[model samples]
Target: MRGIRSLNHLPKRCYAAARRSEALTVPLAGIKPSSATPLPPQNVQVSKLPNGLVVASLENYSPTASVGVFVRAGSRHETVENQGVSHVLRLAANLTSKGASAFKLCRGMEALGGSLSVTSSRETMVYTADCLRDNLGTLLEHLVNVTAAQEFRPWEVSDLTPRVKIDKALAQQCPQIGVIEKLHEAAYKNALSNSLYCPDYMVDHVSSDMLQSFVKDNFTTGRMALVGLGVDHSVLRQVAEGLLSERSGAGAPVAKALYRGGELRVQNNEALVHALIASEGGVTGSAEANAFTVLQRVLGAGPHVKRGSNITSKLSQGIAKATAQPFDATAFNASYSDSGLFGVYTISQADSAGEVIKAAIAQVSGVAEGTVSEADITRAKNQVKADYLMSLESSETLLEEIGAQVLATAAYQLPDSVLQAIDAVTQDDVVKAAKKFVDGKKTMASSGHLTNTPFVDEV
Candidate 1:
């Protein structure tokens, strides 16, 4: 009552002032302001070491950095006697370098809160590390030393067999991967057909000495590249030069990838048949290669949209209408240095496999006969551009792109430039790329229930 009387006694000006000042206001000094304009994307800089090593780096203000070494040595370069050497190297070399205990190396990396991994593909082997900005030098030194000072021990190789066996087993279990491997085997007679995964027989036979020879022969400066993302180019170049040893001479020439497509069928207990039907696509970095990529997008692997069917692809949509059993078609255009495979991989119940395969082949044939619409080409270009841009968002992916570009082609492609190239593609270009793929002999491989999977002649 006393407070109410005091308020009533206040002057009109004072009451108005109190009411106006009563609204709550927050202090904003603790908040960070967002800029109206975004900073421009950083550029990738390339430099070659005096010893023929190529180093590429992109500088950014990211808290984490990626350091990777990419070499043009993978299964495709393996000899018949040393089939799984690259896969073995992926497990062994990084662990047991000379005078370095696998335990200590692993513990040290863990202490630094870093991660290391090795990946081998058909045409490239990459060892990459992700660490903090402050640990750049340590990561670089560790990478170079582990690769350079490696003595592939017999015990180390033997000890790592269980992990290697697990990888092989997992690949076998995934029908998709198994079918693709068989497809490559059927497509290429010798070189490009090299298996990416180790068979059980090859795993035990691959010796430490063989892996060492592979490292010595193929880890040459000319065929190797050091790539860093979110790091200084000059620093990466200096560290790479200071640590990277000189090479004697070039290694044996990698075999040329020839596409002599044929047929392969593996019988399995899987309920559905998995099939891969492919033909020659273009080499990497070619305009036609880009077109095939766009063509692939137009035809589309699985739909970009999640967990649903997209009837946009003529082949896939046609495949659905042709068969009642559950069937799926995913377009793939895998490109290597000299050659590539462009086709669709499908899965379906045995009863529907033949019809789906026929529909898939007709789709490829249809593309050659100018079946792609202009709007389809535009949408595919947009998807391709979007995917490429999304890749740029990751340091690891950007590192792969830059390093692969440098080591494979000695060229760099800005994201804008790649997007522009995709934009320039016409319906006719996509058709031409498709026709080029079909010009070569066709390769077909099937797994699971092989009863309805057609032979090459039927396809």
Candidate 2:
């Protein structure tokens, strides 16, 4: 299973050549051959059990499998009092399994040679198991036990309390994660986006009784999506039917929520100043959202520290006053249910922090004004399209892509169609996306040595 982290081992000379070309020329326009791209995925099968849980499957010949139990209960669903319940739910899933004690649950999975993990985002909470196909049953049985009937014991909650608090503190110290949290806070400060990771205060508030109530409210059959990759969905469905069909609770609220934007700065002890500049972008369905993705690739893709292209140079210059040591910058196009975050982040020396932000803003402004040449668009499109296609080579990524599409939209869409749509975007579309920030309101969060300098004022 080749990964983006692995493909990064290509020769330095290749990156050097790419870096040398600064003239925003569209080399792909006339040279690269254009033909219809065959959709790589065979197809996806989606069905619902009598209990209302979605069962999705995609087959791969690989000897490995990835099984996930996805629930539409996460940070976005929390009120101020229940802020970190989503995180607690994810953690609790790992500690106990169906009618089994925590110790037994851990030992069973370890004996089966399986890896169990869980993560939460704004929209969903996922519990995953990755292992050889031979151990699929053992894994699924344990997963069903944990998700559907685990007991949130008092001792278990007490033991995990300190660990969760430590994690919260660690998140605050890391510049990259801190900046992202801040940017999201700026965009949806009072709603789901603002409090994706429950604060320590919220974690302390999560008693054993609270865990049971939280799980009862959120982890319901009606609000769940069961995803199995590289394994038979029908087999999983038959085996797990009794467990997931148990009635638990209703679906989450689907009404529109409000979000506001402004500067949100949090000072922390780190050498570099980390800045996350964020602006609202369209959600997944809009044409503007697709265009913004292309824009993100052009400016944020590839290894800037090692590849060092013109776009990277602009970022480096922006953060020049901070530190002489090299740092990284990335533009993230994170999609939420109602809106998106077109964010750019930089880790640079604290001294040049203000200059770095100004330079980044200028670069964004230039792209919005259509200063980017056709070549930039062509190369960016190809890079994004090719990378996205290549990701499907692995069963894990393939499954994630399928599930993500289904989660974002009700129907399954081919990745090639998505690529084609991205390729169709012109410089004008890119400019429009860039204008969402350059000429519109923006939000930001910064940590590290940022007290002496401030971000450029928006007019």
Candidate 3:
């Protein structure tokens, strides 16, 4: 009887093993498919609230959601008396708010697997929150508190001094950062001249009152945009109207950035020299700016491949011919709402810095003299279009692009329109852009051994 029972169990086990050996692609023996329909794709929707808050969102049907509040209270808005307030404000994002304690904000986000962060530039500040689609509401509550209801306790604000110093110290480690900061300082008379990092004198001196005043002046609905990705437009609009409407009217007058070209040099003992020479180029969203974008690519905008030689870059090729010494060169283009900067950035051995700088400038001059070919123009335009499209593929970048456009123009521009603008750039346009840079007032900033670096007027 025992042997018979053993044989029966063996057969059952063999049958179960055989069933499990079926191909994964094959349907299971007893599962039914659901009849639910998938959600349709939606385009970006934008609306402006009566209070002047711009609300934009897209329902991409993604499992994760990202929302951002873009405010026009960047470092550019800092007054002479409150320089570096924006830097301190960025670090104070997680401080105790009117609605949530600092600890609660941290623990709440951790519980929901979400994150909140703040980033500021010369023109805008962005507060972004990310979480699963199901937990968006909870995340938004924290986002609102952080962006609008900040308490900015004195103790918490004081505690940020060490972090501020750390930020400056880290920036000091990179010559590129110091050069860029110095360039901005020399490029503008006001507004855009403010440094992103806290100044040494203002690191521990940014008072709570200063932060509050800056917020009151720049966080108004007139200067804010609420943007979202993988979320409903109606939901975002409701939040904009109901929660972020307290600062309804235009909060303060904005001063336009005045460009006054100049130069600043930092002498150091390093053997390598980093230099940037620029001239006024084009304003953001203009046809001239598109031309400059193409011109930048034609000259060279860094290497496309990771750790690959920039053999195709005109700057690199020209500079290589100028000297056998190891050097790096790339065209730099930055467009802002009111003004722009276009130029070349080069790093070379101290003895060859002057030659490298001159060669890079000659490359631009060659483009201005129409030495470039139609093929080069075509390639550059393609690069510009590809970069623009690829940047929007990431959700974070997409949200930022949307927020920037909406905040700047109170509207959103589709990627197709942007590509069309790039496509409209002609070879003549590229040459003209190069000519403008060659003739416009120049601003330069350089660091490292000054043994061979040319002065701005000399270059």
Residue 147 lDDT, candidate 1, scale 0-100: 69
- Candidate 2 is scored at a TM of 0.83
Candidate 3 residue spans exceeding 4 A from truth: 1-36
Q: Write the per-residue lDDT of candidate 3 for residues 30-55, one digit (tens) a residue.
A: 98766699878788898998899999
Residue 111, candidate 2: Cα error in Å is 2.7
Report the poorest 10 consecutive residues by lDDT, candidate 1. 19-28
RMSD of each: 8.9, 9.0, 7.9
Worst lDDT window (10 residues) for model 2?
313-322
- Highest TM-score: give the candidate number: 3
Candidate 2 stretches with Cα past 4 Å from truth are: 1-42, 248-250, 268-271, 302-328, 455-459
Candidates 1 and 3: which is better by lDDT? 3
Q: Quote the lDDT for 37 in model 3.
A: 98
Q: Write the per-residue lDDT of candidate 1 for residues 1-459, one digit (tens) a residue.
A: 544666657688775576653443443568766757975777888887667788888888788888888888889999888988888888875567764677877886887789888888998899898889888777776777676778777887888788889998888888888888998998997877989877667867788889888988898887888888889888987876776755434667888987888999998778888888888887888888889999888886676579887567766787876674446887878988888989888878887888988887778778889977888888888888888999978777888889889997666878778878878888888999888766767888899888777898777
- Give candidate 3's error at residue 57 in angstroms: 0.3
Q: Residue-wise lDDT of candidate 2 within 15-129, one digit each (tens)?
A: 6688765644546566875577854654677776666676788776458888888777777777766678777776777665446778888888789888888878877777888
